[model samples]
Target: MAINYSKLFNRRATPQSQAIPGSGQVRNSAGGYSWEVTDWQRLDRFLILGAEGGTYYIGERDLVKQNHDAIIRCIKENGARVVDRIVEISDSGRAPKNDPAIFALALVTTHGDVAAKTKAFANLSKVCRIGTHLFHFAGYVNAMRGWGRGLRNAVGNWYNAQEPRELALQAIKYQQRDGWSHGDLLRLAHPKEVSREHAAIFRWMLSGQDELGERTVKRKVNCAERTATYAAVGELPALIQAFEQAKAAKGKGEILKLITESNLPREAVPTEWLNDAEVWDALLQKMPMTAMIRNLGKMTSVGLLKPMSAAAKLVVAKLSDQTALKRARVHPMAVLIAEKIYAQGRGDKGSLSWSPVQPIIDALDEAFYATFSNVEPCGKPVLLALDVSGSMGMAKIAGSCLSAREASAAMSLITAATEPDYVIVGFSAAANGHGGQWGGGEPGITPVNISPKMRLAEVVKEIEKIPMGGTDCALPMVWARRQKVNVSGFVTYTDSETWAGNIHPSQALRNYRDQFAADAKAVVVGMTSNDFTIADPKDRGMLDVVGFDTTAPAVIADFIRSD
Candidate 1:
């Protein structure tokens, strides 16, 4: 028996039989053939997923530049569309950070034509929602090119557009960031004062002077100087004034009094006082939903949140509040990070440590799913294939403290909780435990014991216990076919670096389709922007989505259930 040496068998050629426009193939980071998504698709990924912190296979500088170049090309093609996309992502809070959106906006303003620049400038407030954002935008725009008149007015309009009270709060809360301060922006933009309040705020940011000659307004840095005369000052915004009063308050009692009385934000309080349990309890009462979620560990560490304590009850109530989660635009990743960090009872990069409270840990576990948009159950058997390869677990990352490995574990919970029937399996060539070389071995698929009954933090820990090896994303479909498992859909959480296998994932899916579950769909959630995807572009049954996107569950459900 002789095999035909000249004929193709294992690989599927790019379908030239059907002349699909804009269809092209590219080699993945792991030297596997995968479909290349369009530039517009790549731009959405760059804006939402972000290439910051790099990936296991790529360095940060090169990753960022690759995304940057894609965005630049998109800007050149249709700048107004690019601006609209930025506004869409930023305004919806779909991204983990708004830096990518603002940077994209900066590109439009710098290189886009007049209409594009106008659109970018007009939507500046939407993209740069706060002073920190505006400052970062200013720096990116300034670095690319000098600030032209349009840029100055746009920056000035950002300041002018805000209500004086809101602007004052921003000035106090985010006085400086990204090497640009309210004062520096004021000096550079020279924003027109929209009202007397605006004039006072402008003056306050620029100089330590007040609207009237009553007293010197202590610049935020000089917050140590608490003056009694400022209490009588008429023009100071109430929040700003309360922040100063809280800073100047002589004792914990006074600061607590101010926090309760004035509804002062935690940011307004002096850093030294935050170490106090009493101060944290006081701050918790008035903290915004997002702030409360972020400070959960801090509050717990400071002894403010204890089991069955009033603070713990309040925190639990808030964590379980779906309406508040939606209102705060809380992403599932945020809750996952909080759960992982709080469960460990230690901060990853700080001296902070806390004794994990069981109630709070459980609350965070539930809250991670609540942060995502609701999705109807697909009512089908799903195979969740996790890429626990060398690249996926070699480093810890999915933005901030949540590692790709941890994030994929948490992401699977979305399915375990919603879908009635689903199975999770980890695929790696080295996990076989047969002394296979790091990148050389037959792909192994191990059944992962994950269920909604388990805490997400626990699931994360359990998944980490699995040995990792080189990626072979095809293993999901391959395993399903080999084991004759009835699968309605396949969802792979991977970095898309699957090179250890002889067959491509797309071909594996097709082969499985031919046997059973012909209608089966596969969704590949690429955790990193390493550029290639295993899902065939022409195959309507397969999809490629960005990992960590808050709306991913809903999107996945819709796609899987779609006809």
Candidate 2:
């Protein structure tokens, strides 16, 4: 089941002609023109492979040499991609704690040529925001702590001087948006410039006493509101007393007013307040319709809030309103929530209940159509192949509840929604009559023509009906060639653990290109952290990408055009 790519792709270990240093060129097998393989390209492939284990076919020997210098070079060349890879790895929960932290610190402290280092720093600032703002704060801190002495020194340097001010500000903005605890903010502000700039607030946050007994919604609201007000006026002691009084008096209206005026970060608002009908009613009255629709999941999560009948009505009304759909279109989040509601039967049991209105369901279907308004149609027809193998049913996507099969279906739904002219198919090995043997059966795949007009939920339902069996990544190309389907591009969503076929996927692709369109391309959208890819290293027309990334559609489009 294992595939050693080092032996497969690299030259035999015999001393031969070596290219000039720093040229990054290697002579072809035919001893002809040299091809370039930059350090960044190697790093990109290594990341797309993800950490080994699960169903991946990649081994350690197949990867580029991972070391301090090599990692630094990766950051220098590809900034945000590297950081995003680290975050993704960390989020996957498959790697050791040290993995992401080591890479994150290297990204912050590593230097290259002067011009490159300047760009690296700029990239560092942008990624820090991504790490802190888009993901959980605790995760960001854990990664930053990877730089042992480097971290301490960097903190000291920034405190003594205004060093790494931009990075520090990004962290501050994240805290401001997320409503981190006072203690967390103080710890974050230990660096000199940040501490100096917000000295009053830091002192005030520290000066508060625990006289309020246990931390409650009223106390949190009062403290956050008072902190915001007093931080601006430098009145710490008075603010603390006021917070305590607000808590003692059970003055919800006063606390609500403070929260409203201070503009507390959404995360900072207490769950209790969010759950309160009065509080939600008041907040919903003022929030824009778009924000309400976008945050429907958060607002209606179990125990967070009872789905107010009014809120459900508002959502339905907005969905049905032609003018609103024309103006802004339903957001992807709305469609995703709608799908979840239907698939999980959330409306039947939860605090929220959908109206029996047939039009609401129709409107939801229209929302799916609206979501891809900005996605340009591909010039050439494409075929999307989804792997419905047994292994794909075994693991859920990291940090998500959806299994690989479900995620593949969802991603396929997105592709079908966007690509104007496309065909969708599900592939796996045909069932063997005897006790099944690996790679034993003839290649088999089933076509399920998904239409753009169908709702996402409907597409998912159709995808779920396909039977799961052993994986055969080569089946799609084989089927395409046999059926003579005229498609310029192929997109396969799988874990890349292709073991159930007579032909390798790369070879199958080559055969398809030779017999059919010589310029046909394939993109493998990997759904797991496995290192193995079916894409041939020698072919520029083939590519591998991580599934679920926001930029994946654009990457696929570009790859289709060979751009």
Compared with the true structure, the alpha-carbon lDDT of candidate 1 equals 0.77
Q: Count the backbone clashes (under 3 Å) in each candidate.
A: 1, 1
Which RMSD does model 2 reach against the true structure? 10.1
lDDT per residue for candidate 2 within 360-417, as digits (tens), equals 4455666644543345556788999998887777655532345677667766766676
Judging by TM-score against the true structure, name the best candidate. 1
The 0-to-1 C-alpha lDDT of every candidate, in the order given, reads 0.77, 0.52
TM-score of each: 0.90, 0.63
Looking at model 2, the pairs that clash are 159-192
Superposition error at 543 for model 1 (Å) = 0.9
lDDT for residue 163 in candidate 2, whole number 0-100: 31
